[model samples]
Target chain A: MTWDWAISVLGILAGLCTTGSFVPQVVKAWRDGETRAISTRMYVIISVAFVSWLGYGLVIRSWPIVIFNVLNLGLSGVILFLKLRSAPPRRKEA
Target chain B: MTWDWAISVLGILAGLCTTGSFVPQVVKAWRDGETRAISTRMYVIISVAFVSWLGYGLVIRSWPIVIFNVLNLGLSGVILFLKLRSAPPRRKEA
Candidate 1:
């Protein structure tokens, strides 16, 4: 019983750290209006991954996974949107 | 039994997507040597989170979590190192 509680606490803490970590990135991107150093591919892939994780969470009926992925999706989406928006338009080859 | 396989597949897929997503980011960061748009706070927090997750995985005896967190720690560390290295020297307050 006590071990279960400890495990649960650790899991929750880990989840919060991973999920909430994106908050600062989002804030920096939004505030600075800069994403030159940020990786578009990373966000793109992670966004898709979050969707998969969300599906997995739903199938497994794990609320923590579902919640974290939902939040992650939102955060990742914002960064991707900002990065894409700020990107320089590609020029056609002469 | 089949359902068990399906669940396992979904879990693996989700794990792969999240873990593999960082590859592009690392590649970009290495090639460009830029991290201005990235958030130091996010990486710092996520690095700590990865450690926590690693610990949790160990306690739970989950190989996937352990492996993923280890990979994440390495990836996140590189980005953090790049970001910090590229950071402009802080000016002392008057």
Candidate 2:
């Protein structure tokens, strides 16, 4: 029982750290209005990944996973939006 | 059995997507040699999170989590290294 509790705490800590990490990125993007060094593809892929994680969490009935993924989705989405908005113009199609 | 298999696939997909997402970020930082827009705090926290996740995976005997977190650690580490190396000099004390 003690081992299980310890593992659970670890999982929660991991989830919180991963999810909260994005907050700084979002804040930086929002504040500086700069994302040139950030990768659009990375955020795009990660956003999709968060959705997949959320689904898995739901299926597994893990509240920590679900909550963290939801938060991740929001934070990552903000970064993606900022990146896209600040992106340079592409070549015009004929 | 089918449901379990499907769930496993989803979990794998989630792991792959999240782990693979960092590739573009690392590539961008490497190619551009500019991490001005990247958040140092975010990477630092995320790296720790990856370590925590790795520990949890090991405790749970979850190969998927272990594999993905290891990949994440490597990728996120590269980005963090670049970001720190490129960071502007702090104000010097008199």
Candidate 3:
């Protein structure tokens, strides 16, 4: 196969697999209604990174990069939202 | 700023933030000495993705992409390693 074609195939396969890593976590969080294990800091940082990537993609006029990051950002945002929402209620004790 | 420069800036910023997402998880996994919260399947998938990204980067002759994904792949690999190592032992019950 041509180098470009080979790379494209590799890219598609790898992208799908790595991106899939987050799927189980999302499902678990959704199913059990608990996100205690999820880290808020992580989400915050990731959101920032994804936004940067989106900006980069836009600047370069690369639709694939932009679209992928946009979707990733959305997914990460959902996890962050759930994590924040599920924070344990603070208690006032005498 | 030129579009290329702008995109580069954005790429760096976003890359840092999104990549930061995995840090806490790694630290937590390390600290707790437990990877129960981590998903092996997720790691498997991400490793695949990172490889693809690397291939894409190489194909496109993008050094930044290639370097970044290589590092990301390594980081992801570490997590996958730990998760796999910490898998709970199966039990046979009467």
Highest TM-score: which candidate? 2
lDDT of 2 by residue, B13-46 (tens): 9999999999999998999999999999999999
lDDT score for residue B25 of model 3: 73
Q: Which stretches of candidate 2 lie over 4 Å from their true place?
A: none
Name model 3 segments beyond 4 Å from true. Answer: A90-94, B92-94
| Candidate topping lDDT | 2
Candidate 2: tens digits of C-alpha lDDT, residues A4-93:
999999999999999989999999999999999999999999999999999999999988889999999999999999999999999899
Model 1: DockQ score: 0.85
Error of 3 at B60 (Å): 3.0
Give the better candidate number (2 or 3) by DockQ: 2
**Candidate 2 CAPRI grade:** high
Full ranking by TM-score = 2, 1, 3
Chain A TM-scores, per candidate, are: 0.95, 0.94, 0.85
- In angstroms, how far off is B32's CA in candidate 3? 2.2
Better of 1 and 2 by DockQ: 2
lDDT of 3 by residue, A1-94 (tens): 7776876667666655655667777776777777654567877887788788777778778886678777778877877877888898889897
lDDT of each: 0.90, 0.95, 0.74
Candidate that scores best on DockQ: 2
lDDT of prediction 3: 0.74
Per-candidate TM-score against the hidden true structure: 0.95, 0.96, 0.83
Tens digits of per-residue lDDT, candidate 1, A44-86, equal 8899889998998999899999999999999999999999999
Residues B1-94, model 1: lDDT tens digits:
6998998888878888888888888888889988888899999999999999999989999999899889989998988888888899999999
